[model samples]
Target: MKVKVQSLDGGKPGKDIELSDEVFGVEPRADILHRVVTWQLEKRRGTARGARERSDVARTGKKFGRQKGGGTARHGDRRAPIFVGGGKAHGPRVRDFNPSLNKKVRMLGLRMALSSKARDGNLVVVDSLDVKEAKTKALKERLGTLGLGRTALVIDGDALSVGFALASSNLREINLMPAVGANVYDILNHDTLVLTRAAVEKLEARFNG
Candidate 1:
């Protein structure tokens, strides 16, 4: 598939760039995307800190009071639930939330995510992110002209352009990422997916090479 290349410096649209069929032409599957997203979210979950139980509490095991006719009921130890500093009756246990997914499935889901954006016309290509002025106001005007909608995810080559990065830093609706950081979740979370010319080369090479 081919996508028109644009510039962030505000100029006429440039030539079209060809996208890899294997990476940008796959049929998106809801189930596959769901699984990958689920795995990613699960990995981000923090382990629940468990509280001390009766057996875990550091208390004496000696019996409490007289077991006969002392009026009070017989008790086991200071670790019992009735005691003031006693351990909890029931508590949660620490658990690992991370889950594993097949490597092939993970890669496939990413391809489908890219393809979905391409098929939906939400994918955009840019010539470069270089700008004469790195001011936020100037960038806003140029990007607004591109019709990138409400939110966009822009991916560049190895590192982001210093000037462009500074300009777009405060724009909450615009997210920037390097080519190596591309993944399924962030790609699909945005209204538009913009790839720079250098980013396109590296992305295609990542899968083909």
Candidate 2:
């Protein structure tokens, strides 16, 4: 796909960039996308979740009462799951939720995400962005020039310019990341995908390499 490169002022860059078909033209797989997204979210969980099980609860192993009670139902240990403040049965425990997915699936998921963005006209290309100092105002102005107000993801080919990263650090709606760090969540979360010409080339190479 051929897309016009825009300047920071939203004006045409006097040049256009041709995106690769392999990277931005793949058919989206909803199932893979869903699985990948779920995997990503699961991997972020902390190992703090815990629950007391029957074995963990303190209770005498001896019979609390005769196997057959006189009037009431047979009684067991105080830590039985039925009793209040007793240990939980088959409750959630601290463990990993990560699912194993093939590397090819992951790559396809990313490509599909990019393709979806491209098809929806949510992707934008720019020649380059230069920021001498790390200032949020400067980044905000740049985004305004592009007429991107809602959540935006800025992708740079190499290491993010120190100034640009600093400027975007405080903005919750704007995210700046290097090409290597790009992920499905960031791409889908933003209302628009802003890519520099070099960034686009680098992304294609990484995916098609």
Candidate 3:
């Protein structure tokens, strides 16, 4: 499909770029998109939470009460779970929360996400993205003129320019990522998608390579 390329400053229409049908024309599958998003969020989880168990408590192992004379249940050590300051019986342990998905499925999910954006007219292509300096206000105003939405993702090919990255740093709603960082989760999370000419080429190579 052919999409009109626009300038970054005023969003004036320039030339048209042809998008690969395979990458930008696939049929969107909600199930695949869901799985990919879930996997991404799961992998970002920090499994650092820890709980002290019975063996980790620093307490004496001496018996608490007489075996038969005590009216309550027989007690072993002060560190038992039944005690107030005792360790937890069954508690959460530090572990990985990352979920795994097939590489092909992940790729498919990305394509589907891109296709969905294209179908919904939320995808746009820009000639380039260059900032004279790392001025966030200027960049924000430029992006606003383009009607790129308050929350949007700007993707560029290869390495992201330092000036562009810094200019967008203060924009909490706008996220800038390299083409390699493109994923189903970010594509679907944002309200609009802005891709540079180089970014579109990189995306085509990625899926068609």
Candidate 4:
């Protein structure tokens, strides 16, 4: 598929670039996308949450009442789960949330995400992403003039320009990443995708290999 490359400062059409159909023109698979997104999010989740068990509680373990017949039932100790100050019976424990999926599935999910953006007309191609000065305001103005959405993801080549990286760092709504960091979740999270010609070439090579 061929997409017109445009200027970063102003949305002027430049030369067209060829994109691989397998990479950016495939039909999006919702199941694969969901699995990949879930995996990504789960891997980043903190596993520090824990609940104290009976043995971990500081309450007394002495017998509260007779083990025989007593009004309402026999009591064990203050650390019992029936008591208010007792530890939890089966609460959540610290454990990793990382999910493992097939490598082929992950790659396919990324392709689906890119293809979905292209099919929805939410993908924008640029000649290159660079800034004269690393000023946040200047970059914002330039992107605004280009008619980008409030939340957009910009993917650069293997090496991103220092000025462009620093300029976009302060913008909360804009996400900048190199082709290596491109993934299904980040691509689908943004409202629009801005790709440079070099980034597209890199992505094509990556998927092809």
Candidate 5:
């Protein structure tokens, strides 16, 4: 698949570039994408903390009162849950939230995410993100000219350009990342996906490498 490349400012139009069918031409599968997204989010969850149980607490195990009724009632050990500063009767146990997933599923989901953007015409190929001035206003005007959607995720080559990164840092609607950091969650989160020429090469090479 070939996509036209343009400058970020939309002033210069570059040559068209070819995209990989396996990467950007795939037919999206919602189920596969859901599984991968769920897996990714699940891994970010923290384990539930557990409270100390009766056995775990450091309390006197000695008999508190006589076996026979002594005035009020007979009592066993101070470690009993009813006593003050005693261990809890039932406490939640620690549980790890990490879930295992197959590697292929993750890869397929990423491809589908990229393909979804391409198929929907939400993918924009750019010559580069290099800007003379790293001013946020200038960059914003430039992006506005491009007519990118509500939210845009720009993927650069192996390393992001410092100027573009700094310029877009304050803009909540615009996200910047390197090709290595591109994933299904971030890709699908944005309304538009912008790929630089270098990013395109790296992404294609990544799957085909």
Candidate 6:
């Protein structure tokens, strides 16, 4: 598909970019997208959550009462789950939430996400641009020119552009990421996917490989 290239000033560059059908025009697979999103979210968990079990609780091991009821419910130690301030019963534990998906499936999901964006007219291609100095104001102005508010993801294929990255870091609605660092969530969460022409090519190459 052909898309018009725009400049930072939002002016048409009098040129257009040809997007790869294999990457941006594929049929979106919702199932694959769901799996990829789930995996990405799971991998982000810290797995540090823990709850005290009966053994971990500080309490005397002596039986609080006889096993048979004596005009009251039979009771165990103070650490029993039924008691207040006692150890949690079947509570959450520290464990991995990561879900393993095949490498091919991951790639497919990424492609589907990209295609979904393209189909929805949320993807835009721009001529390669760089920021000589880290300036959030300049970045904001540039985005303003393009009429993009809300969440925006900027993808660049060149070596790390620290200035550009830093400029967009403070903008809550803007996220700067290299082509190699692009992920499923980053692509789907943003309202706009701004890609430098080179970044689009790099992404296609990476996924189509």
RMSD of 2: 3.9
Q: What is the Å distance of residue 35 in model 1 from its true position?
A: 0.8
lDDT of each prediction vs. the true structure? 0.91, 0.82, 0.89, 0.89, 0.89, 0.84
TM-score of each: 0.92, 0.76, 0.82, 0.78, 0.91, 0.75
On lDDT, the leading prediction is 1
What are the clashing pairs of model 4? none
**Predicted candidate 2 versus true structure: per-residue lDDT over 6-108, tens digit per residue:** 8764445748788898999998888989977887888887775789988888877676777764676786778888887788999878887666878888888
- In candidate 3, stretches whose alpha carbon ends up further than 4 angstroms from where it belongs are 10-14, 55-74, 82-86
Error of 1 at 172 (Å): 1.4
TM-score between model 1 and native: 0.92
Model 1 regions lying over 4 Å from their true place: none
Q: Report the C-alpha lDDT of model 3 over 1-209, residue by residue, as the tens digit.
A: 99989887664577899999999999999899999999999999898668899999999999968999779888888998888889998988899786779999999999999999999999989988876667999888788877776589999999887888888888999898999999999999999999999999999999888
What tens digits encode model 5's per-residue C-alpha lDDT throughout 1-209?
A: 99988887556689899888989999999999999999989888887678877898898888867887578567677777888888878888888888998988888898999999999999999999999899999999999877799999999998789999999999999999899999999999999999999998898888888
Could you give the candidate ranking by TM-score, starting with the highest? 1, 5, 3, 4, 2, 6
TM-score of 2: 0.76
Clashing pairs for predicted structure model 3, backbone only: none
Residue 201 alpha-carbon offset, candidate 4, angstroms: 1.5
Per-residue accuracy of model 1 over 53-170 as CA lDDT, tens digit each: 8999999999868888889878879998778888888878889897999989999998899899999999889999999999999999999877897999999999899999999999
- Flag the better candidate by TM-score, 1 or 5: 1
TM for candidate 5 is: 0.91
Better of 4 and 6 by TM-score: 4
lDDT against true structure, model 5: 0.89
Backbone collisions counted per model: 0, 0, 0, 0, 0, 0
lDDT of 4 by residue, 1-209 (tens): 88878886554568898889989999998889999999999899988779998999998878877777766576677887878989999988989787899999999999999999999988999998866788999899888866677699999999998898898899999999999999999999999999999899989898898
Q: Among these predicted structures, which one has the highest TM-score? A: 1
